[model samples]
Target: MSSLCLLALNHSAQADEAPLTLPTGTISAPALDTQDISLQTPTSAGSRLGLSALETPASTESLSGERIRQRGDRSVQDAVSRSTGISRTGTPGDGGTSLSARGFTGQGSVMQLYDGNRLYSGMGTVTFPVDTWSVERLDVLRGPASVLYGEGATGAVVNVIPKKPFTGEIENHLRLGYGSYDSQQQALDSGGSLNDTLSYRLSLNRLRSNGWIDRGDSTSDFISAALRWQATDDLAFTLAHDYGDQQPMNYFGTPLVNGRFHEGLRDKNYNIGNDKQHYNDQWTRLTSEWQLSDSVSASNELYYLKAQRRWQNAENYNWDTAGQQLLRSGNFAIKHQQEQVGDRQTFTFKHSLFGLDSQTLTGVDYNRIRFQLNSNSPFNDALPDGQPLDLQHPDKGRFDSASAYRAQFQSTTKQMSVFAENRTQLSERWSLVTGIRRDYVQVDRDDLVDGSQSDKTLTGNNWKAGLVFALTPDTSFYGQYATSTDGVGGLISLSPSQQQYDLARARQSEIGLKQVFWDQRGEWTLAAYHIVKKKLLTDDPGNPTLKQQVGQQSSRGLEASLELQLPHAWQLQANAAIVKAQYDDFEEQVDNQFVSRSGNRPVDVPRRTANLWLNKAVTDKLRAGAGVRYVDARYADLANRNELPSYTVVDAVLSWKALRNTTFGLQLNNLFDRQYAQSQYNEGQQWILGEPRSFFVTADYTF
Candidate 1:
């Protein structure tokens, strides 16, 4: 009983399976599989099946769901700007929307996850914004994964997998879109299967845009759901949920030579007259899974999120004896509230010992977070003869202001891990895979403003070892070593007595190569890594200096990726990243530097990056795609003498399947409207222009 009536009696016994006819030797096939039939597909077991740009031993990238619905990407930073060692910093008024893997920038050491839990606000420092149609796949795990996730991955780990529900029948989809400074979007998806152990899925999304500069505007909405249950034949159970909302539009900073790239003086009335900024966000999640038997299985998850923001600016005066030109106004308010509750329990086991082939994973996790921040400012200087100014009468009219600020913080994190994995075949050509993991972490932090409060605590231990080798059967080679830790933040901007800096450690080493050719339609990967970070938390200058932490730094890297599936329905992919970061000793602000020798290349890092996509399937109801992206020069501060010039962008897509579960799509983004500047300061400038070439025409149906 219950569990949806035993999943409707296992979906009416699988709809009473009928139609069957097969005689003549009763089909005994697969004898021509002499060459091992490409190791029997399914990615030769090890259940980590490709995608994420053809997953290798490490360094990953993926954006599928039909290439994110043919590239009309609306958020999640437009699918992480099409990968390649990602970079997007301090979006939304100087401290939100940060991601900088490899050279590690914001959110400390990059780590954001969903579906596998951990979604920010555990006092690991802030950075949260996700609502890309509830993402259905986007895993980019490169470098440190903190031994099964814990601490801020010293520069990598972003998983957003969501979208599950399939068994038999019932499927639906709907999408609508519009473009250019008056954008609009709508999406909906559904799933079925209510018997034989049940199945379900639901998704909804909405987005609106009116931006191209000048107080850029935006709106977002989302909802997601999933469920699955099976009571026997080895057992099963699952549940999931997510919700979202956002309102963005607050492009600040102007001055950089009057904000280039004309668009009616970047939205007329110039002179910083019409200034207004806003923010509102919400999030939620819950999950559960179990199959406790026949080798064992278990999982559990829960999450919650909230946010708020507001700002305004306007002030100027000239009057020149009433000749006109005077407008003054000011108001600023920011209130952020966040709460998080976490849980993760995992247990897995498999068989075969002496003959090798084994698997064992054990986990325990607990997290608690509470946050609050409030700020306010109001200013007015009266005129119109209502009288207010006259503070020794140096100018003529009104002047009055008020201010208020508040802060509260709390955090608790606990994690324990133990894992074991092994696979040994050593004969039929040879096979060997090994794994080990050990982790333990505990952290606590509490900081409440004025009322005088401060507390901090930390403990850590991490380790990981890996090895995989398979010569034939599609190739394989792997090597890994890991260790990670990072924490300590009280709103970083430096100088608040450098916030008692401490806690930072990282050590990583990787070697990889994996390949699957022809039969599987082509795939290639290559990786090389070297990382060393110890107590590295720089920026300290006498008397607390607003919190600072430092103790050495080192990073070395090389990555390569390629994907090809040509011969009719063509497609090609590419990725390349290189890093060499320094400063492993010596400190005297710039006088005793041990490295960094002013060779800046770690701030919004970019040494070289590339992307190319081409797809074609002319007939069978049209299909076309084109793409190009490149980056090289970057460094807009960190004392690299300002530089951010190196840009290339192009994109195109057209898809049609006229009928049979219908589909029609058209998209063109940044098709040659380039003009870059993704960050800058010294008054203001943060442009990465070229969003004008947008066109969307989508129609999808499945049932």
Candidate 2:
């Protein structure tokens, strides 16, 4: 665990205004026996006060690893995009796999966190923590999370929490599986108490696949290990490390034939035979917590991260009707090497304020990131116009270059932040939660090709306030308002031209209701929110020849989720969201001229998304489950002229206990073999199709 928030809270019940003593004596680990009941579970990503999902006064979802496996979700993206108000917009191998939430899109808006620490993207790309095998749970907070995190989180924050060490009987878990397209998966997890005051946990996973498309083979490996020591009754320390190495599929997307899908070309691979994409990452963290007194506690975390990524391929393809060939462009080779170090310290106070119970938290965070890039752009090495191949049958030629890759750029980013949060019980039926955060960021860039340099310093201030009212012992209503910010582009890779603009600013207002009924058998939540963003760079309205930061965009949406455990050993889970997203004032440069895009929906921002899952226990050792997912149509370009059609897919799973400590399962994905675009590239000219019907057989054992 990278955060001390895992220390469970201890409330005083002597009186309504009794002082509370938040304890840090024992670690709080989630039980692996249950798959539901997230409403009552505490999440560190949602709040620093150790509040449960229902008490956070915001929309949060906690999906356990067991629940995800039962649903047959293999990738982190597959599990996270199923939550309310979220949809995928890119692929992991494309240097970045981004998402759209509320009204915001891309890596510059939605952030990713591993073990409660940010994975700073070098150039708008995040390629670590891709697999879900090592994850314990995923905590999602939707809409304007800058008050809890920091900048670049106007859309949402997805926290990937790995399994942690626990003091108990030694246990070991092993899983092996085989799926369609010659895919194989293997995983192992072991943990236990090594001594009276020490515990250790380790996880390993490997995956290999001969993908559904031609020449699309991929492999990945992940390892995580942790050790925990309780020095005294009031102090504890934990050290953890994670490593990942991946070689993702070399396929980009299929080019459209006459601006439409061609079923005949769905399985074609139109790139050099040696196309490559690789990512390697390492992360290490040490965390310590001390209970200074009954009413005071402190914790600190120190961490380091390193990442290396490389790509070489023909990324874009254009159809040539007359010539009966496909013209490929954007042929490039690029590399990124990044290193980061950071530390976070927090102090917590639990006492009475104005004769009411109050919990206050203050924290300071600092991190420095260094990044370097190497690439062969402008095609100075031959093949400047790109390669053309026959439409029907083509020779997959080898990658040929006359010169070696050259240094492109190197940059450094330093940031410091201070934040405070407080939760107070105003009365028996009402409470207030508020937080404030400020960040100072500095970015410096050097262009190796031209010997150009640029530097910029930015400051961001964020705050949020909310009120929660207990309508009943099992129901609550809440409302909140928050502010956030996003850089115009990836901060670490900011170019000289982009350094002239300030970070975009955004604000959001939300209201929600949560309830648990039917004797803990059912739970539901509903939320509605509106967000507005300004300072977007756009063409000057008076003079279309110039650009200015006077543009605006907004979105309003409603989201709902429900989970129920019915009679006769049946379970149901469902969620849906609808959004109205539009640009109030925006423009794009086309053919050296600016065109207004006001009132246009942002590209890849779907208006509606929904998911439903149902499971039944047929016998003491047998179970069955099925799920459905739907995504509405979306515009593929700012002009709103190209549209990607809506799609729906279904999946099913069955499991049987074959032994006392072993289980066998079968999973069928894309049950209907629905043919639809999962993502797009080259301004929607190319479409990455979704997987066809596939099946897998898996065995899981625990000892």
Best by lDDT: 2
Residue-level lDDT of model 1, residues 440-548, one tens digit each, is 5444445554354444344556655555565766777777677787665432121223335555788888887777878787767777888887775554455333324
Native-to-model Cα distance after best TM-score fit, residue 204 in candidate 2, in Å: 0.4
lDDT of 2 by residue, 1-703 (tens): 1011222332333236545676535644334434654688887777988888778888999898888878888877789988887888876443546888997888888888998999788778998785888888888999998987888998899998888888788899999999998999999999888988888889999999998888889999999999889888788899999999998877788889878888788778887787879999999999998888888899999999999999887777887777766877666788999999999999988876645677889999999999999988554535655578776665577665655679989999999999888888889989888888999999999999999999999899999988889888789999999999998888888878778888899999999999999998999999999999999988765675566988999999999999999999999999999999999999888776778899999988999999999999999999999999998988889999988899999999999998999999999999998888887888788888888899999999999
Top-TM-score candidate index: 2
Per-residue error for 311 in candidate 2, Å, reads: 0.2
Candidate 1 lands at a TM-score of 0.29
Sliding window of 10 residues with minimal summed lDDT for model 2: 1-10
| Root-mean-square deviation per candidate | 24.4, 3.9
